[model samples]
Target: MNRHISPDGYRVDGPAGQDDETGADLPAIVGRNLRRLRTRQGHSLDRLAKLSGVSRAMLGQIETGKSAPTISLLWKVATALGVPFASLLTVEKQAGTVVLRRDRSKVLASSEGRFTSRALFPFDSERQVEFYELRVAPFHREDAHAHAPGTRENLIVAKGAIEILVGQHAPVELTEGDAILFEADVPHGYRNSSHGEAVLYLVMTYVETVG
Candidate 1:
């Protein structure tokens, strides 16, 4: 294995800065799930690589949380494992499509404080829709992140402000109560321009199931 170290703020062992019972543990939870699925299918690292066309080294890295897999790679693994790509993602359950209370949410924060995510669905939900509350502190910016082929990210501003930059489109600014929905295939990033903190809600979908 390459034995790559966890990025400064990111946790390679699991979701960073989250505890076992606090819902902050998505990375770990997801990692375990992947391991379980792999074991259940009687596939080894080499077998997964041959089946998914992903390198065994890469699979080891993903399974160990030493790296973040690109959306395409994730899909390949999911396909080989015979599971929905969304099944590998971590999300908390919501009461409905309207709101997600803080108390019932799981917060995923990077150790470096770059970003924080609160799940809107149970971490193990099989639903097609996934909701996340994202917080980007001042001076914190995100690299382009994308999901499965048909995924869409609905960004709604609940507090503070942020600039949503998607692929080649001009950046869009969202403030409190403002929201934007777009295809998540192309690269995207979030920038917090406020002097203090900025928060937003991101609802990601594997298909166009939610309008």
Candidate 2:
């Protein structure tokens, strides 16, 4: 399977669970997550260095699991990826009947790593409602694909500021403790242009009840 690596920071690896990151494989987990996020965003080590403000050499070392970064350094990289610092630390796991902690949740990132989305619901293919939390870095915009017919999305700003744009309408600006709901069948997006990070809890609901 594609770990999404290129010449700048590429590596092919086994699929999740085959050789996925676990609690014991912290460094490898971080490296794998970083590589996947970087490649999906089309970032080479050089480009990631520019984005994360970390040296390319260090970025390479992190990818190869040869180096462990300080918490501050990890923050820089997480900010660059528009994801929470905990995301890089999360371990890959199979979906379970119960998830006891957010820190242990599985994470998915934007193509550019400008946004990190944590799944809050069980990985049920038939589930109609999907819940998630999103972390976005300053000045980052995330485009979301349209969902099923009659689908709707609801969001609450847990922290910072954001602008939600649905279809051709003007963007709606929100601050801490604000909320919005809109049809998700059409195109939509979230934008965070402030100097501070934005945190949002999102709920996506489809028309039909999933079984």
> Highest TM-score among the candidates is held by which one?
1
Best by lDDT: 2
Would you estimate the TM-scores of all the predictions?
A: 0.65, 0.55
Off by over 4 Å in 2: 1-97
- Per-residue CA lDDT of model 1 for 128-207, tens digit only, reads 67777787998677855455467778988888888988889998988889999998767888888788788888787775
Cα lDDT over the full model 1:
0.66
What is candidate 1's CA lDDT for residue 133?
73
Clashing pairs in 1: 15-27, 91-121, 92-120, 92-121, 92-122, 93-121, 93-122
Pairing residues by index, what is the TM-score of model 2?
0.55
Tens digits of per-residue lDDT, candidate 2, 51-149, equal 778999988888888775654466578557654344565554456565536545555555355677776754323345668888999989877655445
